[model samples]
Target: MTNLTQARLFRHENLPFLLAALLLALLAGCAGGPAPAPQATPSAEEAQQTEALEKMVRQGRHLDAALAYSRLANRAAPPLREMYSLRAAELLKDGNYIPQSFQLLSEIQGANLGPEFHIRRVLLTADIALARQRPDEALAVLDSITSQLADDERDFRRRYHQLRAQAFEQLGQPLESAREHVLLEPLLDDPAAVQANQFAIVDELQQLTPQVLDGLAADEFGGWLALAAIGKGVDDSLPADELIARWRAQYPQHPASEATIARLLAARPQALRTPRRIALILPLGPRNRYAKAAEAVRNGFFAAYYARPRQAMADAVPGDGGAPHLEDAGSNAPPLQLRIYEEGRGAEAFDAVYQQAVADGADLVVGPLGKDAVSRLASRESLPVPVLALNYGEMNGAPPRNLFQLGLSPEQEAREVAQRAWLDGHRRTAVITPSTPWGDRVAKAFNERWLALGGHVVEVQHYDPKKNDYSLPIRRLLNVDESQARRKSVRRIIGEKIEFIPRRRQDIDAIFMVAFSRQARVIRPQLRFHHAPKVPVYTTSHAFSGTVDPQMDRDMDGVMFADMPWTLAPDALGQRLKGDIARAWPGAARRYTRLHALGVDAYRVIGQLNELRRDRAAHFAGETGELSLDADNRLQRRLLWARFQRGVPQLDTTEN
Candidate 1:
């Protein structure tokens, strides 16, 4: 009846005792009249139906049992009929017959069932409503039954709060959703699970004002808030040190208070599941769409494998110049036997290649770099080996545990830019991007993330890639054209000129630009010319080419962006690698230089994948970015922040 009693009754050691108690309850309800007088026998039809009901229940035919129970309810006394209807409703609910379950419960709505059954019926009814995407109806039902649940009936009490939480989420009421989790905390038994749930709630509350979180931390959800303060992946609105101090002052007795702070400085989890043999699948044809990219990646992977840590090769300058390069490995780190296979012949051939890779003793498969190849692999029943798919596959249900999707997606970069902007105190922003599919995708991703974070997109301007002068879009983005129109109209009305300064909209504090190095050079100065100087401009890695011509790029002196460490890490490790790339591939294209960095990370990641998967604090600072695995199991890279100063991209060491 009570939470403790229910827990004790259902515990493994008490399961037999529980079954005996259930037997007595069932017997007390069904055992016939007083023993002094002989009881009257039921009709033969009733006897046959009762036997059939027992048989259906025993055979695990729940739907059939529900049907038989419904028939029996028709002939039973009022109290018996209520019991029969409740039994049928439970069976239908368990069997996922939502319509039937709700119908049966509705039939018994007037049967005068007590608080326990009433609460269960209400919960089920609301659950069915939510399953049908009717959150408003669910909320109404949940509201009507509020007084029925008590601490004694913790089963339904727990479930009631869960339904309310989900309903509020569907209804887009975040505080209410968090309130349910707060209500749920005391009902849970395991501390880890409770902390995990609270962290999840914190994730949903990322955009909430600090005042709201502080109030909650001091009140009903103190422990939950404290745990959330230490939770992984949270976007902290307050400084971490200040937030932890506030939480401690609010709740001094909470464990993990100081210990949680220590984890932030600890190293990432070690690789516990590294594969000995790896399969490298690339489209090797000269004409393949990603052939060159794949080659660069492959070369980069091997260079990383051999570029032993602490070796001078990591810092050596390329013979050609100080360009990005992958130095050859000489040190004796036992190499992962890489088995290469040809792909890109056709999409249908991917499965065969994958199967062959497994047969060739590959414990880990790196990729089928083509998008179509990854899609085909995803559609399969399962992957035989742990796969680090080069490109993202179509998401259909939970992907195989072995499947990991990694890509240099423009969309990923855009989303990160939005998050960084929000963390940096930018609320009203404008977007300046090129007029192409890639540009459209990045802009859309930024807008989506920004809007979801409660920020506004003031304007989005698309410009032609070939255009050198972006004055028109600049004028529109800054509201200068409108300012000019107003000035002209005022001049005409007064028949004389008055002192006028073009006013850009005051709402925007940040501008997100998605452009290549050339376009960035042209647009950065144009943005300053249109009275938007001093407003922070954000861009992707596109803002900086691997090579820098300070004279040519001085116009982009203040733009910040996320870029790989291969080009911008500034330390000796980066310089050495850059020298390697320049000497190894003397004529390497500037843009493709990062691919070599990608290859380096790809090889480095195999050893660290287990670390990322298991430890929330763990991340791999590869050539691509700061890499971590997300809830969706996708490998996400949060790029290093850099600002161009005098044609060189320096790390933005300022706090976000």
Candidate 2:
């Protein structure tokens, strides 16, 4: 039926009347007109047929009911033919005997028919032909109803064009189909209608020949027509945007046109150029341990910026000058008080410095060296810039939105040692650590890494650092023939009846020793007592932090450990820092290289502050080789492995 008639039939309040009309139409044919003076009786066959059809229909056996109705309509009279046609239409609505119902309706002569019946017959015939893929037949049926169709039946017109387009597409006439689509486009203002039609059109175009699309003009529909066609095509070489732009230009006033264009444009990637200003806040004061270290960091940053040729440096540094604005954290009590308490008690002294930096238009904030200050800074909130808090250990509280900590931990060192040793073929390993909590922490990290890398820990023994005795734990970890003791017990039970053969000793491939320089010195010789001198030993970074002595370097030789690259002066940055330290303090050994390397790396990566803040995977080359931020934004350093050879700690080139 026409859209209006279909809507009218399905209306909520009119549904009961429609059903009653349908029932009456069905009953009229069986009753054969109004009863003649109330004395007329129906034939048994007629009554049986009516009862069976009604019972089947009520029971939802629409196909069986349709056949009964068709047989009944064949014998019905002229006056009752309308009821036959109506019954057939109802059967068609039930989606049973679709073609046969239409065929039955088509047999009706133009007699005393109302507009509703005429519309119903024509629409139902068209629906059947369409369902059977006979679009030409459906169009012919629709053409017969054109004069009777109402002007308000716009949805029918749209569907007519849509179906015509589908027929044309099936006939391999894509251009005609496209023209019909353009004509129907006006009725697609509703989102649901547009989406449905768009999908239908796209699906049809996929089956059409590519030459149809190729024949279309480049700038057609400002390119939406071409894009839609291209989107339908299988080839990826189509110029998508050009087609879309043409289509959009043609239909600029169309609803959701701009939104579609914006969505399509947004899908393309574009690089954003955002300028960033970083603030370095450091304590530059007399007699402070970090004063020279801070200066060395500043020098390192300047060196990185100016490391290239003059033109490259000029391009990198802002405004042709390479100097960065630095705010000293101050040595005097008043300035420190002003920096901290100007806000509040718990507020950090660096807060004011940060505020000043923000006021000066900084995008990133870097320092405030001391642990207490960094920890206090971490606890506060709502900082204007992203802060890279540079404390040496894990901070006390939650960091701010843009704040990150970039410090090394003993756990991190232990994990690195375990990974390196496992990668270096150390499967059967032993761990000899001190009884302190720090030693336990190292042991835990080592155990985790060793287990993760599919290595077996032969033994884990703890030793007291204060005691001079290290022979017992060292000997137990190094000795591995427990079968001998088992054999001895068996011998005692069996006497001379069984002679037990001794099993060969299994030497531990490696030892992960956790101790200070003094304790390490005592334990080094004990490995020789167990006859496992050539067994490789790995230590944590604490071993390199002023713990190794020159006198005991021979005993500690061949012992490899993970440490910052600055400890061995691996690169130019490390070498420069070492030179500065030697020039500043001639008598001072390179023991302070760890602290120096921390400063250099912290400064060097400041250039990548934005990337570091945004991307957790961003890696940087530092005085400690390669470094990356972990999930918590803690700096995980790519440590260097140094071997103590002869009388000096030599950097291991092969493993890092």
Candidate 3:
């Protein structure tokens, strides 16, 4: 009893102290224990998955990587989820899955993300707008957020500059585009990337003319201006290597790599050999079938020849057993001798005339207009002298040596029409061609080029070009016959007739009609009557006669075709020639305008052939078109586009 009483007193006295010591022990334990194992972070497995997905992106398996990132985003939390979503959208856009990427991008709210991710979202949106060819929208979106980006964010800044540059390029602002590339170059670390950016800068600068270039600050672009000026100043005489050496000495610290300089040097036009004597052979004799056409060509040739002061004719004198030789008068350039030889129709006749021209000391022979004659000259294993044939040869293999062909081939125009329609965003097309050889050639060329561009020819219908009526072909092309037949079947099934309008096939986005104006005028209206008025009609130059007769061409409205600048918007030289011809040869000016242009171009090309031959990129601004020489030595043309509105052809300013 005494021990129990003592223990009770001890317990009562120590109760408060024991309680305090226990509470202090509990607090110390709580503070010292390993901090609550940091709330579940991205697991090792998730990190590994991220690395693998990034690896896919590096390997260029963008779609696969994008889909994987989406899966990860679905399972991840805030910030991380937003980041993965942004990444997925980027890859999809890069891979050209625009609609799907935009849809995914719409699902992610950028406001909730961090500064970096929000910027990424904005860039992706702008990029998609650019892909859809809406540069204005892209530029607006970028301009709004440009101030928010920090200067030190090199990667984001680089992308921002690139998108801005591309937007400017699409909007036809080359100078602005080049400025962005110039800014982007310094931010790029990789050597190849830097080189590419430099080239892009030069390319944009090249689009500017010398007059335009003069207005720009030379020092601002780090020698890009000097480089482009050197490119533009290149002539037929100055050696490109020498120019390059001078450029190097002038700007030793320029950023353009040696590779870029080398490429420019390779593309430079080589020195040309101006012929002292030129012989023109054509069927110009009175009895020749092409005499009238040949005379028109001869007039055009002389017009171009006399236009140059270096070749002023003294007087015509009869040569020894050949055509008359016209000697050049006193001029700065060396005296030139021009001789005209009358050609016969057949290849053998062309051979005789060609032999005579070459024997007559002709340094260059330009002529023999018939296709067969050109083919004959082209078939020869070797020619004694260079000949720029006026017609293209039907060669089964590589083009012959020393023979350059330049002609207003319908095939070239057909290919250009296909290109124009393709660029206009047309994919599916129906072709209606005249049942003729020329029509077949044009249609074949269009089909070959259109298909090569990954376009589809839904249906091709050949119509009788001679007949004025194009109902059958038009109906077949639009599938109106099928629609009408279905209506009839439905009426029979219901034992009654109902009011109906024939419906054309909804799949075709365009129509490629190979017809002359007479045929096209009738066909276009029939197309409208067949319920396909809005479908864009694309054609070759044949659809528009060289003269403007809006009253007659009114029915040919809304038709787009590719034609020569001489017929569309001739420059000062062309206008002068037109005026002169109108006063001198009014009838020929109206009747054979295109043929006259052809002759003028033929004469102009003789001096330019060497430049075109040496450099594939060199162009001659001829009356025919923007002329360039193909690998086959065939002169190809980039024609201007024109659309008929209320019967008159208006030049399309959007050809570029």
RMSD in Å for all candidates: 23.2, 28.2, 21.9
Q: What C-alpha lDDT does candidate 3 achieve relative to the native structure?
A: 0.74
1-656 in candidate 2: lDDT tens per residue? Answer: 11011111123222222222223434444565543332123458777877877887776555446545654655565444455556656575553233334445545564556665666666666665654456778778677777775767776667667667766765667666766776677676675455445544444555546676566544233244444544443335646666566555666554436554444344222211132455566655554556655554444443333332222112222221123322221121111000110111223655666677678676666666666776676666645666666664345555665566666567878887886675465678889999999899889988987886567888899998999888777756754346557777787887755765533247568889998777876787777656677888889767655434577666777778777655554566556555654554444335445555665676566556545544443456577545666545566666666788875787654311
lDDT of prediction 1? 0.68
Clashes of each: 5, 9, 0
C-alpha TM-scores of all predictions: 0.56, 0.46, 0.60
How would you encode candidate 3's per-residue C-alpha lDDT over 421-479 as one tens digit per residue?
76565779999999999899999999998886568999999999889899998899999
Model 2 whole-model lDDT (C-alpha atoms): 0.57
Best by TM-score: 3
Better of 1 and 3 by TM-score: 3
lDDT of 1 by residue, 1-656 (tens): 00011111123222221112112323343358643322234458867876877786666556556655765665565455566667777776654444445555665644355666667677878887775567888999999878866667777777888789889887887788887877876676665545444654664575467887687664545565454545442546866677667766767765444543444313111123557677778776667777778777776766665565533222221211112333335453444455667765777877788788788787888877877777776666676687887777676677766677787877888887886676565779999999999899899999997886568999989999898999999899999999999999999999998999998888899999999988999999999998988999998887788776788888888887887667666345556655666677766636578887777777778777765765443456666776777644578776677778898777664331
Report lDDT per candidate.
Answer: 0.68, 0.57, 0.74
- lDDT-based ranking: 3, 1, 2
